[model samples]
Target: MPAITPEQRVLDNLRDTLQAYVAGDVAATAVVTVFRGQAPALALPEAFQRVLDELLRRLEMADVFSQDSCSFSSTGIQEQLGVWLDKAEARVSARTA
Candidate 1:
């Protein structure tokens, strides 16, 4: 069995955090608790951080668009995150490969 790397751990944490956030636990405390003491262990490259920041910004923009369209839905946001994750995962794979 291969050992899990720090990137794997952080990615798993991110998926879990996104799930919890979508499942009505959207609170600052919940988010902080998810990353606190967990995220600092990784020494991810700056490119990876930019990928994450892009995900965040994309989601924020999606939320604003939803508000403007009057079609706000958590599931829509989750789907947006899913697309962002696919893109980010591809970026990471390309970087690592």
Candidate 2:
């Protein structure tokens, strides 16, 4: 077997962190949905954007937020920012796991 790369190690950690939720050889679709629902509508920093995009990509959704996307929201702006903070923390946990 080939040695694991750093990126693979990171993904392994992510899979492991959410592994409990993926019982009986399942994917984490429901969990991803929960996380995405909590993610906010904001113009993410590049690093944050990539994490959110990957989270969405894994979740099979297309709701990546950028400046253009952020512009479309009209209400509850502060709530959105708060959710982004939650998402950022979630992103950290997902990676560091």
Candidate 3:
């Protein structure tokens, strides 16, 4: 396999985080919690962080979009995350398979 670009790495990290959430991995949950707490101070490359941030925002919006009333809720967020993770995992699996 070719080396993963920085942008790809950011996407992969996001995907992995979501996968961990879907799989109910405690470690992943803890990591995410910590990351969220520290996200404001974490010094990441501008381009990489920009893409990741945009992706996250889009995912959050998608969560609200999935609701019948177009409102956001914890349930909507979880559902959206699940759907996004599933699709991402499938894409990764296809690439590797």
Candidate 4:
């Protein structure tokens, strides 16, 4: 088996973190921290990072307010994160190939 690259490792961790958050096994802050902490290692495009930052910001906002009080939708943010992961995985695969 080919060895996994650092970017792939970070992406895997992000996936796990996202899953944990969705399962309510983890907190939003922990998920955000994992994303930010692993971002540099991924070295993804600036555009990707910008979107990620926005999602993280929205996630934090959602976490702050109760569901009834918050306009921000945690479900929407989670869906966006899933899309981001899909694209990131494709990009990394292409880059490493």
> Please, what is the whole-model Cα lDDT of each candidate in the order they appear?
0.57, 0.44, 0.49, 0.90
- Runs with alpha carbons beyond 4 Å of true place in candidate 2: 1-27, 41-46, 59-87, 90-97
Flag clash pairs in model 1.
Answer: none
* CA displacement after TM-score superposition, residue 67 of candidate 2 (Å): 33
Model 1 stretches with alpha carbons more than 4 Å out = 28-73
lDDT of model number 2: 0.44
TM match of model 1 to true structure: 0.51
Model 1: per-residue lDDT, tens digit, 1-97? 7676666667677668877777766742454455444544455556555654554544555456653363445466567656655655565556665
After superposition, the stretches of candidate 3 with alpha carbons farther than 4 Å from their true spots are 1-3, 27-75, 79-97
Model 2 residue 18 lDDT score? 49
* Candidate 3 residue-wise lDDT, 18-46, digit = tens: 66655657343343453344433334446
- By TM-score, the candidates rank as 4, 1, 3, 2
Task: Give a tens-digit lDDT track for model 4, residues 1-67.
Answer: 9898888888999999999999999999999999999876777899999999999999999999953
- The TM-score between candidate 2 and the true structure equals 0.29
Reference-based TM-score of each model: 0.51, 0.29, 0.35, 0.93
Candidate numbers sorted by lDDT from highest down: 4, 1, 3, 2
Of the pair 3 and 4, which is ahead by TM-score? 4
Whichever of 2 and 3 has more TM-score, that candidate is 3
